[model samples]
Target: MLGLRILVHSIKLVVRNWRVALRISSPLIAVLLVFGVFMRGSIAGVATLGPDEGVSWLAIGVYLIAQTFSGTWVAVAWHRYVLQEDDSGAIIPSFMGRRVGAYFMQGVLIAIIVGIVTVVAAAALFFAFSGLNSLVLAIVLPLVIALVGLWLFYRVSPALPAVAIEEALSIGDAWRATRPYSGSILVLVIAMAAASGVFGALVELTVESSTYLYLVLVMVQTWISMMVGISVLTTIYGVVVENRDF
Candidate 1:
């Protein structure tokens, strides 16, 4: 029930803030689509790569930069908007500033931490149960580890909104604050993963029909996933950090 509430509230936050949301997201979404179109070949090639094959570092770097910038820009703006913390009072959100930079850096740090934790957990589980592994276990183990990493990520994500609002929250602070709510956050993560998987399965069902339709659905899903993911983090931050009513 807690997870369901988080999911519903996150969607509502996006819906209620639709005007400012669209205003800030439009230009960045255009940029992302244009970038995707230009990099379509390389992006598509990623899925077809052999075990020994690798993508070009340059292409990967460019794509990551574009995605990270666009994502952080929208997140910072949305956080400020929802918290009533931004005094910019502009029609659209700001793209360049200290807040975005700090958010980006902190994001990178969090990614590193999550990656390290995931790797360590996977390794530990692999070695500890080396002789008991089955085909199903092989497939499930990594997925479980990834989900654990995501749960940990959410537990520490309040620092992001704190950064946006210039509240000086450390990563440790965020983690400690949400310690008791770990189970709730895990529930939220599972619910989100289930929802995304369902949406993706439906989209896959349309892939055989029309390429245009598949592309449109993919873009829409991507946009919704991005916004809701940010909103979830923002909601968690509000409830935990600001003691906002859930």
Candidate 2:
């Protein structure tokens, strides 16, 4: 019930603060547009990368780096807007230097932990079912690993919001904060994914099959999805960790 309320509240918050949301999300949307343009060219030329593929690879790498930086900045800005109750600022703040670095490091650490869990689970499954048919093992192992990864991701997701708020939180703290709401968290994740999937499907069914149109729709969907995600996470952190009302 609380999870449902949180999700509803998130949507309401976005609707009520659409202007602020747009400001916070503009940089990310811009970055997505640039990324889509470059990626389209890269994908179109991928088949012809016979001799001089260095420039293409470099462009891809640069896009990845820019995307990462922009993503982190947007996240931090949203966090600030939510936690600090500040609604008047540039879309991207001018002085998120150390904060960005800290958030990036926290992200890296979380990824490492999730990766370790995945590898360990895979190893355990392999050894525990050595006698099983190879085909069964091959099919089941990946599914099991994916499930475990999703669970792990939900477990630590609150940490990102905590990092955004400069909450002096550790992974263990986040894990503990969300432990009681694990089931709610799982439901929230599924609900969000299903909503996004359905929206994307609708867009695909209705829109003409133009690459540029697809990219534009994707970028718009991504921005809205990200804003909702940020709102959800911030709300969850407030309710669970801070014991406050949304």
Report lDDT (Cα) of residue 182, candidate 1: 91
Give per-model TM-scores: 0.88, 0.79
Candidate 2 structure lDDT: 0.74
Query: Runs in model 1 with CA error above 4 Å?
Result: 36-61, 85-91
lDDT tens digits, residue span 7-47, model 2: 88888878998888887877777777676675564322222
- TM-score for candidate 2, residues paired by index: 0.79
lDDT of each: 0.79, 0.74
Give me the candidate number with maximum lDDT: 1
Best by TM-score: 1
